[model samples]
Target: MTADPLRIGILNLMHDKVDTQLRFTKVLSEGPYNVDVQYFYPQTHYTSRPVPDLVQKISQPLDLKQVATMDAFIITGAPIEQLTFEEITYLDEIHQLIDVLVANNIPQLYVCWGAMAAANYLYDIPKFQLPEKIFGVFHNYLRAQDPLLKGLPDGFLAPHARYAELDIDKIMEDSRLVINAVTKNNFLFSFRAREKNQYFLFSHLEYGKDALLKEYLRERNANPGVEYIKPQNYFRDPLHMKDPEFSWETTQRVFFDNWLHSVADHIATQQFVKE
Candidate 1:
């Protein structure tokens, strides 16, 4: 008999709600297993302004009961990295969601700032502001082996577009955490706490070919007077650059394929024990 579809919940926290959802769905659909993807947003996120029509149409309120039904969960990064963690309005709800997911032993993936938030909240590792943003495709080397990195190469490229860096030393020191990948500059690329069934990825492996270019152009257009640097290792010709080389397509596909497989394996194990 065929198995049930894997239920995946994405807690959408990005400003570009539609585009963020598209990026995740595009990568996830390429996997072998059948998946039911749902989008959710923090209930406290829209207290000041009305919810956007597109967000309202695409997502539902982040109810804890609904979150418990998912086989796995993903929390996307937000643009509020500069703000103190306590200053974030929806953090209490996020913490509660994390509690529920942890209580249920559900697999969770936290991306970029979401990862930073998790590290801060769960492990007390803080994120530090950098002098300049790390806004480009960077090389990451495998630091340790895990099922999630099954098909990934020893060295691979992924996109990093953030202004803050997590405390690498603190993460490395944590006995419960496993450091999987890191850049030559010591930036933590990926890590996990196997006991908690939680994973963290600092780079944007799901970004589209022109994702960085579009962000660059939009930022420059919004601030015409400020000098902005083009994303490093992105353009074929720096002088006449319009498009980015989609070098990480293979990495993106294999990583998500491995992740889905991992989740499927977990589900099968649970079913076998119950039977």
Candidate 2:
């Protein structure tokens, strides 16, 4: 008998989590599995004020029970600062959630900050630290062929924006996670969760042109005391440079499609046994 479609639950932790969730859904839905995305937002902001009701309305907190019911779950990055992994307020909850997913053998994916969260939870590595904020389309080299990048080009670009970054050397030390892709600058990375058939990326694969623009503006407004100047000042005349043919949105969809296929294959094989 044929199995039911794979049900996916997305855990969005960022202020713009819903946007990323929707973009991911759009890409995954085009694949074989039935995609169902859910958003999760934190209660406090970097400044410790309650997130506005409008933003809160878009996402709800997720628990282990809720996560157990899904075939797969995805966690999005957030715009928060952490000197150390433990310093993050939601670190404990994220760790618990990851444990539950791993213990239950649930497939999962994490993007950007979500990647950092998984690395910290699984390897006890500190949060990524960077000398400057990374933004715009970044080039990454694929190490080996995996189902996740089945039909995509050999090299691709993804959107990025983060002051902190992970140490690739430390990530390499952890055998549980497999490094799928890396950048020449070593600022971006992608991985697959071997035990759970999950994936993680340290770039924004789901961000569209407008979404990137909004992020640029938000970063500009926040003025996080970083000396890095805004892209607008440098690329003022050719705004489309932000959304080149090798756009993050386009390449991200390819990555998302690969995830859907992995989920579909897992569901097909009846390998998703709940713990």
Minimal lDDT window, size 10, model 1: 235-244
Error of 2 at 15 (Å): 2.0
> What local distance difference test score does each model get?
0.87, 0.68
Tens-digit lDDT track of model 2 for 1-275: 22566667776776665566667667776665566666665433334666667666776756578888788888788776445665677677777788888887778788788888787777765665676677666677887566777666666766677778877777677777677877777665687756666677787777666665677667767786654434432233354635434355557666676677776767767655532
Error of 2 at 266 (Å): 1.1
Query: What does the lDDT come to for candidate 1?
Result: 0.87
The C-alpha stretches of model 1 lying farther than 4 A from their native spots are none
What is the clash count for each candidate, in the order shown?
A: 0, 1
Query: For residue 71, what is the lDDT in candidate 1?
Result: 94
lDDT of 1 by residue, 149-196 (tens): 887777788888888888888988999998999887878789999577
Candidate 2: worst 10 consecutive residues by lDDT?
Answer: 228-237
